[model samples]
Structure formats: structure tokens, C-alpha cells
Target: MKKLALAVVVTMASSLCAMAASDVTKSPPPAPYEQVSKLVKLPDFLPGMGALFVDPATLPAGPFLAYDHGGKLVSTIYMLPIKDLNPDKRFDNLAAPGGNVDHVDVYYNAGHPGVPEPHVHVVLWHVPAADEARVAK
Candidate 1:
């Protein structure tokens, strides 16, 4: 009877340990922005100033900036290619009739491995009316 009780206790303990280990490994990994935000400082020009978007479930990363003519945030720039960007192609298109885009900056993960894979930090800046130096400010 003593041996049987000991065997049952050991089996229960082993089963619990296996369950805990599986839980740890089955959980999704932490998001990249959570990791990057801790390391880098986003440029001051960034309007909404916050962590860039990066859904691990989705490949690539983005800190896209899409604002209205009045400087209101329209939406975040996703991973759409430059060629596919249309209708609102030029900086003037995004700004109010009179208001010009000073510059636009986007952050991404440069280390992105490839399609369906992970990446590192990547930043894309667009200055429709001015040069890089002018845009930096």
C-alpha cells in the first residue's frame, strides 16, 4: 500500500511538470516593438510618438505615418510597397490644400528575415517638398 501511494504521487507530480512545460512553450512569443521600444528612441518628428506596429501573426513591421492636411493622424502606415501607394502619392496630396508635408518618417524592423519570417528595425522617411536636412527638423 505504501509503495502504491508513492507511485501515484510521483506520477501526479510528473504530469503536472509536463503540463507546465507545455504551457510555457505553447504561448506566442513577445511582440518585436515591445523589445525594440526598450532599446531605441523614436525620432522627435514622429507625430503620435509611440511604439511602432508589429503583429507577430503578420510578417514585416511598420511605424507608418499617415496624417491629414491639418496634421491630424489619419492612420498608421502599414507594409504596403512604394509603387502600390497611389492617389495620395505626393506629400502635397496628404496635406491640406495650403499645408505642405514637412516630411514623413516610418519605422520598421530592418532585421526582417523574409516573407513569412521576422525582421528588425526599419525606418522610411518621405519629404515631398523638402530635402533630408530640412525634413529632419
Candidate 2:
């Protein structure tokens, strides 16, 4: 099961890396979103990462954007508490070798500025240590 989950995460990470490499014009995330972005100092671009994003209506401050190495938009990161999600069908585990034990919520198309018309939204919460270790490794 661990291996299976790891494989899934690997696949997802691969998907993230090879994502839609669009040139998202840098802009402040919409109104309410700006407050948190300011608080976190979420950069328009992170060192080693292509870009950062914040979608306006996502809960708990984001569907924060994380672009691919090529500066194309890919996954989103959300720092949400476990209590907010459904207990059943959830996957909040300790991070695997290179995977997340966190809950993941995905969205398709849905339209947001800078994102391509057919895009994806990846929500993350409570990631595990295992996953963290892989990133650092």
C-alpha cells in the first residue's frame, strides 16, 4: 500500500513537473487573497521554483500556486486543518518516500487568472514527514 501510494505521488509529481508551461503574468492574488500572501511573503517566484500563485476563492488562504521548473503553472498548495475535510475517503497520512500523507483535493478547468483555460488545481494539507524528507533529499 505504501508503495502504491508512493507511486501515485510520483506520478503526480511527474505531472506537476511537466505541466502547462504558460507564462502567467505576475499579479497580486485577488483582494482578500492578498492579505495572506503578504503575511506569508509568498513570493511571485521561489528560488529553484518557477512561480507562485494564489487563487482568490480557495479556502484557508489558498489554492496557492506552485509552478513547474519551466515557469508554467502546475500544482497548488493549501495549508488546511484536518477537521475541515471528510473523514472517509481521505488520505492524510505521514509523507511517503516522495509523497504526501496529506489530503489532496483536485479541480479541473474552473478558470482563474493566469491559468490556462484547461488547468488543474491541487490542494494540499498536513503533509507527512516522509514526503518532506524526499523533497529535502
Candidate 3:
């Protein structure tokens, strides 16, 4: 059962990564941005999180895609609630949809409107450390 679940996750990640990569050059990022936003209610951009999108069906444990102002894919994020993290609860092999990750930043949030739970933002940055300045609004 565990193996089957893992396989499903891996397959979803691969599909998302391929879609994001291929559609990165599109006018408005139809795959990750337009398509995802149509499925979920997200703002155009978040100060520290960048342009964000998530599959609504995968809520709470989202492999959320973050893009820069110019519509460039920057990172993949997972909002893991503090209550959900324990020895018994393991989230392994989370995907980075933007291919190679340059760095990772994990931080705490005290609950926001979209995700109203005390959770940690597990950010997998695709751009170099310096290039992240693009999303610093």
C-alpha cells in the first residue's frame, strides 16, 4: 500500500514537472499558473512566496508551485502543518517541479487566510540564491 501511494506521488510529480518545464515559455504559464489558479483561489503573487499555484485536491499537503513576477518558475513548496509532523508521519521524496533545486528554505507561518494553520513552508528553490531577489516584493 505504501509503495502504491509513493508511486502515485512520484507519477504526479513527474507529470507536473514536465508540464511546468515545457510551458515555462508560454505567454502566461497556462499549465502551472492559469490552469492551477482556475482550480484554486490564489493571489497573483505573495511577497516571500512568489506567484503561487496548487492543486486543490492536494490541499494541506500541496506541492505548490511558485513562480517569479516575470512568470519564471522559482520553487516548489509544501505546507506541512506543525501538528502533522512527527516520527510516525513521514513525507519523503517530495518533488521539486522545476527540475534541479539550488537550495531549500524552511520557515514557520502562524496561519494565513489561504492556509489557516500553523505550518512550515518547505521551499525548494529552483533558481540560484541570488536569483531569488526577483520575488522579494
Best candidate (score: lDDT): 3
Residue 123 lDDT, candidate 1, scale 0-100: 30
Worst 10 residues of 1 by lDDT: 24-33
Compose the digit string of candidate 3's lDDT tens values, residues 1-137. 99999999999999998776666432354543443445546557878778777766677778887888888888888999999899889998886656788899999999876678899999988889998897889
User: How well does model 3 score by local distance difference test?
Assistant: 0.77
CA shift of 103, model 3, Å: 0.4
TM-score, structure 3 vs. true: 0.73
List the pairs of residues colliding in candidate 2. Answer: 53-65, 93-101, 95-128, 95-131
- For residues 22-131, what per-residue lDDT tens digits would candidate 1 score against the true structure? 33111121233232222344432433332233334333324333333333333333453444346865332221211233444455433322222323222333334333
Candidate 2, residues 33-103, lDDT tens digits: the string is 33333445454455432355554555443455544444333334544433434565343542212123255
Backbone clashes in candidate 3 total 0
How far in Å is the alpha carbon of 44 misplaced in model 2? Answer: 3.9
